[model samples]
Target chain A: MSVITREEVAHLARLSRLALADEELDHFAAQLDQIVGAVARVAEVATADIPPSSHALPLENVFRPDEVRPSLTPDQALSGAPAVEDDRFRVPRILGEEA
Target chain B: MSLIHESAAELGRLMAAGEVSAVEVAQAHLDRIAEVEPKVHAFLHVDPEAVLVQARAVDERRAAGEELGPLAGVPIAHKDVFTTVDMPTTAGSKILEGWRPPYDATVTRRLREAGLVILGKTNLDEFAMGSSTENSAYGPTHNPWDLSRIPGGSSGGASASVAAYQAPLSTGTDTGGSIRQPAAVTGIVGMKPTYGGSSRYGLIAFASSLDTPGPFARTVLDAALLHEAFSGHDPMDSTSIAKPVPPVVEAARQADVAGLRVGVVKEFGGEGYQPGVLARFREAVDLLESLGAKVVEVSCPSFEYALPAYYLIAPSECSSNLARFDAMRYGLRVGDDGTRSAEEVMALTRAAGFGPEVKRRIMLGTYALSSGYYDAYYGSAQKVRTLIARDFDAAFHQVDVLVSPTTPTTAFPIGERADDPMAMYLADLCTIPSNLAGNAAISVPCGLADEDGLPVGLQIMAPVLGDDRCYRVGAAVEKAFESRWGGPLLKEAPAL
Candidate 1:
């Protein structure tokens, strides 16, 4: 069986929020299938008894004292925004019909 | 020798002794960059005036009798992936083109605090996804050894900067083998300190679990100097280790492997490895034995699965990490001419912004992380990660450090593997397990490959916090090889 079908790649692109072209969908489907097939070997040793390691180091919740520190000013925070209005990020319509 | 060609340590010593001013050192490197950058394309941005201002400040501080760090006056190139307030931090992607970060990456902040002059930001693969740097939306950085070949990436520009004498020191991040592979091909020293040894607070994320910032330099001691300067506990980074940074500088200066047990990984050699690379690696191992170090061949069977597991896990993490690049916030925004919804704009922007490899990985990650398929792909890859770490744990029990060829071959030509993703990934074949296990590893040039006349790297791997061991062994092998070759391996590189 194909590891990833063209339709599945399209679905993945949607979930990934990428508007891939039709040809990209075809090309990536073939490539992702080969890649996915090769990486499938991980399942051979991934038995139920073996535990998964999410990170290399054991981490703990790092807490800081409830104190205000120097932070980016509104100008600095919005400096890189593609569109800014009133010191806030301006985006297109989020719900309902397009504006 | 040209001032630009001197090591960071030598330059700093000269500056401290008043033999050369920080401005002079910075100008020498800037002049070299001007002469060679058109051919190497190593830097994405260079502002000579800004750099000289920093250098002048260092000179003034020294004149005022202010105590300076050991590397106070050295010039360094930072990989563009590290955000910089002064320079546009593109991370080699058009999506972030011209985006000047409001704050500096911890590495950048620390380098500045240490009085190192920031020459400019070097190029890299887009979001650090590819091996050859062809994935860089800007352009590929040509290897200094041969302009037609790659410098090995995604830290290609970092290695090339040091290799081409544009900078004596540079910083690079290794997720897969970005640092080590680039350093190997460019004939320099690159060390990936233990994961979390350095802060990643402002580094543009690729695979957070595997991302490690490190140093690149012309020599082991210089690499250690840069490593120590930027590494330590940072409360801002939740994963930052709470302990003090390992004493790599002292270890590099010690440069002794006497009585140390060195294990040669059995799986790293044989099929698919270039004969010349193996030849140099064997000679390095032999030299270690001659230096009073005992050498033994150790097996790590699970290593064969590291590449596959890495491909899955890295992309899976990247999918989640890269989601922040929505057109709503920073970076490139497209197709939002008041006709599309927020979702449509985000989709259009991502598709237009990301390079092919970046998109490919994102899709691959989304597929792996999607429900129903997550268990077989991402979950299994995590399990294999544990196995790989266990392999390292087992190997460390028998040896002080493990040694192997850094990559399967020397630098291939620029376009040889660009079209082939799997072929490109093989460049990290020997370096990935160390990242997966979050161990400290360093790549030092051993010798030139007999066939290609390109540099081959001998990788030194140590336990998690045993970063110093890597420097010790790397320095020993580097000294031994320099003596045998009559100078540094980079001396043999053809002049650009």
Candidate 2:
């Protein structure tokens, strides 16, 4: 089993969407190396013939009836909001790219 | 009243008879919280007033001579991950700290309908990521058995509260070993009903496929009653099993090991496990044999790969599941002067909101799912998952149940393995496969580890939807060992 490296850790952080500090990077790097080393054993025995599984049971088209039902009013929905504006639950602009 | 220590069944009987008020039961738990919470650190948020209000409503209903479910008037706390309208569902993470959900999770709703008094929300590892409660951003919950040692998590606080007598029953969600491991350390009964047995409508996601919500309590029957209340389909969760929850309380009382076939997984019972754990486990198996259960060695050869496969699959899903925490949604927001972009705001919020363990998982998950690596990492991990499931399927045909040590050893000292992530990950080795297979499992206090005198749990697992069987076998074995020991293990633990 190979140890995880700093670049791999950095790449993972980018994928995860969090910016880590310089101090936290080295600590996580070593930690990840150990964890990955332990978990890497699966690759040895996982053969090509086996189809990967995601869920234990197969479920198909499990949807609820689409009917309007009483839901929390907008005020109730936004009751826990730290900030709001124009009766809408205010959030920072979610889609950062100009649309 | 001292009935705070009474079983959920006893409380229900008292409430139905109008001999003890629901409010009285709720108040006793609230008082217990005030008395023991400092040392146990079990609750994240508790509303004494709200608990009393809910209790009084149950009392009023009973005073009017209305029908009630088995858990009515029984006080219970939920793990912080389960959403509750009356309190913030933090999931022990700063990302959603102080955020109250718009609606209660279906499990929480079911408990409310059953008139189970809502005591509070308990602590857990942030995002339920770690085996030990040490990963909790709030603070590690001290095992009631030995205050300096960790209460195994991510359901640490749930088990701790019950063990500490802060509440008689609590809810816990196990992904890997969260529920069972904590139960082992705290000397309580925790059962992860078959995956999808309990609805996940409002439980903040943590590896969605593996997550299971279950019950924690002082006895098998108590856990069975609370589990019965929540184990059924909810329109909100597609994965929820459509089957009605089997009568677990009846199973617990009628539990018999006579002629039962139990498989001792060869992969689990071996070295790397502490000697004390081995000794206690051997004795537990012997006791099972004495009770007339046919115990034999069985191997799920693929389990050797379970830990690795789980790490990959769990992180991949967690990365996707946790994306909802971007500051733009409903939680803490930071950064962004209008001149700066929203992207910057999300970065800052996430960085500030999440702790090290959460960040590590998100990063690892993201890496596993990234385009170039997806086929190599997540894809291969999923394949391993298939093999693990097949292994379980093969083993079950030969045995009615599988048994193993809940953890490699008993509770470890705080900070002992926190810095060593691999050692910490190994803590869930025996517990991870059940989640992968969606099997029902329970960890009941079997005996104390000979070395530390700390508790060792005997984990019993059964086929999916065979939840009542776990209780039947577990209750029988628990009685066999508990009777010999004279009482529950925690009763003998040095007072905190």
State which candidate has the highest TM-score: 1
> Candidate 1, clashing residue pairs?
none
Q: Could you give me the TM-score of model 1 versus the true structure?
A: 0.99
Isolated chain A TM-score, each model? 0.94, 0.77
lDDT of 2: 0.86
Task: Report how far residue A3 has shifted in candidate 2, in Å.
Answer: 6.1
lDDT per residue, candidate 2, B1-496, as tens digits?
3776677888888878778888888888898899889988998998898889999999888878888887888899889999998888899988888898999999999988988888899999999999888888789898888899999999999999999888889999999989999998888899988888889899999999999999998899889988888779887898988878877878999879999999999998667899999888888899889999999999899898888888988988998999888776488887756665666777778999998888888877787787877877788888888898898899999999999988898999999988777778888989999988888999998878878989888899999888999899889987887788787677787765
DockQ, per model, reads 0.88, 0.62
Candidate 1 local lDDT, B190-215, one digit each (tens): 99999999999899999999999999
Worst 10 residues of 2 chain B by lDDT: B336-345
Candidate 1 stretches greater than 4 Å from native: none
Per-residue lDDT tens digits for candidate 2, residues A75-95, read 887776667898886666656
Worst 10 residues of 1 chain A by lDDT: A90-99
RMSD of 1: 1.0
